[model samples]
Target: MSSIASFVRGVETLNGWVGKTVAWLALGTVLVCFATVYLRYALNTNFTWLQEAYVWQHATAIVLGGAYTMMTGGFVRVDIFYGKMAPRNRALVDLFGTLLFLFPFMAVVGWAFWRHFWSAAVVGEGSPNPGGLPAWWLLKGTLVIFVALTTLQGLAMIGRSLLVFGGREEFAGTSSH
Candidate 1:
């Protein structure tokens, strides 16, 4: 049990590190936006790539950081019924939801998305926008990446549910034993 707790702790720590990285990348997007405003309005010449760059970075950061958000309880949830449930009941609800819905969905969608990504990649696809952006497949790949991480997050959630049901503190809340 102690070893398992340590493993979870390591995952949580890795999650924090991943979150910080994405946050930094997102913050960098702010700087990129600033540069775009300068280039477009100030220099009187539009940089189309800048816009594409922002979308790519912004989306990547958010998707990659999703697990970290879940780790920190930063994602929105339908908590109307959740808040009313007792602890054990809540755990039960969470266990079933993760098992029956979340994990399987992530797996299936993640698998399906890779097919889309591969088709795009194999065809060397790009958007129809004239000088708009290059290689649409690159952006589409984020779907697979997001699903992979989000699936791991689902696994973490399941671990948390199990620990909670067994009456041991999980996530970042409990002291190391």
Candidate 2:
């Protein structure tokens, strides 16, 4: 149990780091957009990296930040069903949800997208609209980034479920939500 607790703590800490990293990345995206706008209008020159940067930078932050949403119980779901359940029952649902639905889906997306991204890299893929952006690396990176963060949060959720059913949760000062 203590080992699980330790693992939960470790996952939680990593999730926090991922969340912060993504937040900063999003902020940078915002700045980049502003720069692009300024460049386009004020300088009379279209920025080359803006389109690719827009897609991947925003996507990267979103991917990296998804785990924080899951771990914090911020994910959109059926509260009508969930809110009525007892703590133990809720834990059960969470455990099942993470294992059966969430993990598999994220895993599959990560797996498939990783390949797509990798292929893009291998082929030196890039936009070809005369002056687009080179961003196969950035786009592909999001596949792992999102999955890794989400997986970490999923592990923490699993740990929380274990705590709940084991009768050790009351002392843990943790809420599955």
Candidate 3:
């Protein structure tokens, strides 16, 4: 039980760190987007790389921050149904949802993204648009990162749920919002 608790805590801590780090990309995304728009309209010039830069930053932030969102209970759910349920019941739902939905979905997405990333990496793929960013494989790799982080968080949720089932509700961590 202590080992399970340690695992849960470790995963949550990792996701927290990742989430905090990835959050900086949001600011970068906003700044780059503003620059892109200002350059296009105010300066009467457009750079494809600048345009794609914000998009890439936004995607990276979103993909990398998924586990952090999960840890913080930020994902959408039917709160009307979930909110009314007891803690144990909620844990049951979480366990089933993680097992039945999250795992399988992430597996498929991870597999697909791995293939895409490998292909791009092998070729050193760059943006298709002229003057766009290079190393598109890095962007493609974010999908795999998303899957890994999301899956890790899902496992933590399962461990937390098991704690709840074992009458150790205090270790269950945050409730879904």
Candidate 4:
């Protein structure tokens, strides 16, 4: 039980740190977008790589930030019913949801894309656009990172649910050990 709690604590801590770190990418995305607009409209300069950079930053931020959002209870839920449920009921709901929906979906998608990321990395795939960003494989690799982190968080949620079911009422929603 202590070990499970410790694992949950570690996962939450990791997701929290990663989420905070990737959040800076939002600022980077905005700045790069502003630069792209300024360069296109004012200077009549267009750089495919620079444009792609903002897009990559945006995608990376969103993808990587997902686990963080989940950890912080930021993901949207049909709370009309959930909000009214008792704590144990909510835990059951979350446990079932994670088991029956989230985990399976992630597993399927991750399996489907496994070869794609592998091929890209193996071949060092690059952007098709001339002068576009290089190492496209790196960008594709974020898919794996996203899935891994989200899966870890999902496991943490499962652990929390188990703890709640085991009578650790304090593990209701938050991922504190």
Tell how far residue 143 is off in model 1, in angstroms. Answer: 1.6
Cα-based TM-score, every candidate: 0.81, 0.86, 0.94, 0.96
Question: For candidate 1, lDDT tens digit of each residue in 66-159?
Answer: 7788777677889898878766676677678878998888879888889999999999888666666788898889888778766666666666
Best by TM-score: 4
CA-lDDT, candidates in order: 0.74, 0.77, 0.91, 0.90
Candidate 4 has a TM-score of 0.96
Q: What digit string (tens of lDDT, one per residue) describes model 4 on residues 6-60?
A: 8988999999998999999999999999999999999999999999999999999
The alpha-carbon deviation from the true structure for residue 9 of candidate 4, after best TM-score superposition, in angstroms, is: 0.7
| lDDT tens per residue, model 2, 96-132 | 9889998999889988888887888888887776677
Which 10 residues in a row give candidate 2 its minimum summed lDDT? 168-177
User: What is the Cα-based lDDT of residue 30 in candidate 4?
Assistant: 98
* Candidate 4: residue 113 Cα off by (Å): 2.4
Candidate rank order under TM-score = 4, 3, 2, 1
CA error at residue 25 for candidate 2, angstroms: 2.4
RMSD of each: 3.2, 2.6, 1.8, 1.4
Q: Which rank order by lDDT, best down to worst?
A: 3, 4, 2, 1
